[model samples]
Target: MKLARATFTPGVLGGPGFFGGMFELPGGYLKPVLVSSCDGVGTKLKIASVMGKHDTVGMDIVNHSVDDILTCGAAPLFFLDYIAMGKLDSALVADIVKGLSTACQEVGCALIGGETAEMPGLYHGKDYDLAGFIVGIVEKDRIVNGLTIKPGDAVLGLPSSGLHTNGYSLARRVLGETPEALSKVYPGFDRSIGEVLLAPHVSYFKTLQPVMSDVKGLAHITGGGFTDNIPRSLPEGVSVRINTGTWDVPPVFELIQSLGQVAPEEMFRVFNMGIGMTVFVDPSHVSTMLAAMPQARVIGEVTAEAGRKVEIV
Candidate 1:
């Protein structure tokens, strides 16, 4: 098999070691329940590459991909990645793979296979892009699409670690390039801008795994922040009202807001603000679910409306 012929040792390569080991279809035959999602690190890679920190990006890609399919309530089975750079460096690639392998292993998913490209001119030297494909499976009856989400459901929010792979384009513009500028630690931050911006995208698979089946819908707050991402999982006629002060905002967000003069509403629209993933659950299970997932807070509640609306307060 292709996995066997890989130049890296069986375990050294992501595919053979991480994802390939844990996932198996119910039957011996090839046909099986499958769910897949694809995503990239977005402009966050620019920060990593600029800082010469190629290590955490693999985590960003895997976590981002994992969150994409997790919206479907299916646990990840395996992941495949694509890495393209103007030139290839074994050390850099290894750092990326190490992060990928660590994430895949923690989530109990396989890092199945991928393609790496060393283009001549398409990419500027040392500048690269990463994308990942993830596959998951759920029973015919167990899939958790938002079809069941109804008005009056409780919206539980999982805290984000910062921007989490979104809004970096604007972020870079607001905060100019320079290690000294970036290295100046924001209040409450022991690290610098580079560290916060490069913070590995948080993975919710483990935290939400136990309660996945009980929730009606799940939303991964990504590029569009709560305004855009939350609606993707809402049923017709249902909207969400979020309390802005429900959780303490991470200081990094405050710095961005203060520096960019980012409006309160605009901040919520552009960044995770604080909440990363939101789960809509039935009233009956809300208490139990919140108790189980301590990292979550009752940020909002679902309601019937003409269209999906996200309220900051």
Candidate 2:
């Protein structure tokens, strides 16, 4: 209760109720829409349990949910989490909550409330699952839904921090389940496989804040990777042409592909490969967008191609 109260601002969220909590948003908008998203850490939690690393996964769920809402040009207002485990461990719960608080503070979102379940039969051993729900607000006219995307609009790729909470199931299978397999030193990467795979998912709220108005579309590269996620923001009759070699593919992806003997096309379809987010910008605003995000690169462009929604060259 204290932790939840600490995350709320006085005017935004209402006082607690007997049955449930109250959330109050100040009213004064020409057009306001509430955008909500729910996401989980997936099989990444298995690796976290194996390694006994609980702190970063909290941020993973929060960041992942924030990015989903961000795709609709919304600013996060509050976040709620769900934690289920075989048995409740106070220390583990606190560590996870600490991470949630830290991430929510960074993104300026409130950790309003959450549920923790202790189900000995449902979950086995120390295993637990995490899910996050976030709500944000966006003005109607300010929403970027790729309707403005044109054939010549530039596609900018935002670098990802490793897998970014996706592809862990395939990665684990390829790397093996034992600690020795995870600890083995792979060529090209200075850190162990565990370290690289555990990198926190980057939140684009801060990076895209300045250029949100300039973006025609935004895609949060999650489960679908480039093939599926990018098309979500693309309008009808338009498609994306991505130049795969534009940016250096991270070594972790290379190792996964090599060891798993996964097809090149499948790699782009499964993992983020390298780019975590994709933004469509008008040719005129490309320079300004680039200036705001120096790390972004021109990985592709919008096209008027028929049938195909995304193409990787």
lDDT for each residue of candidate 1 in 1-313, tens digit (9 for 90 to 100): 1112122223333344432333445454243457898889888888887788887999989998888888777778778788888887778888888888888888877776666777868989778888888888776576778888887888888988899999888788888666676677777779888888998889998988888889888889998898898888887787888877778889888888999998887787789987889989998998899789978898888888748777667
Model 1 deviation from the true structure expressed as Cα RMSD, one decimal place: 3.7
Q: Which is the leading candidate under lDDT?
A: 2
Every candidate's lDDT: 0.80, 0.86
lDDT of each residue in 1-313, candidate 2, tens digit only:
2123234544454656421255677477579999999889999988777777788899899999889999999999888888888888778888788888888889888788787778888999989999999999999999879888889899999999989999998999999757778777787788878777788898999999888988889999999789999888888888899998899898999999998999998999999989999999999988888888999999999999955389999
Q: Estimate each model's TM-score.
A: 0.90, 0.94
Measured by TM-score, the strongest candidate is 2
Error of 1 at 33 (Å): 3.5
Off by over 4 Å in 1: 1-24, 27-32
Clashes of each: 4, 0
TM-score, candidate 1, is: 0.90
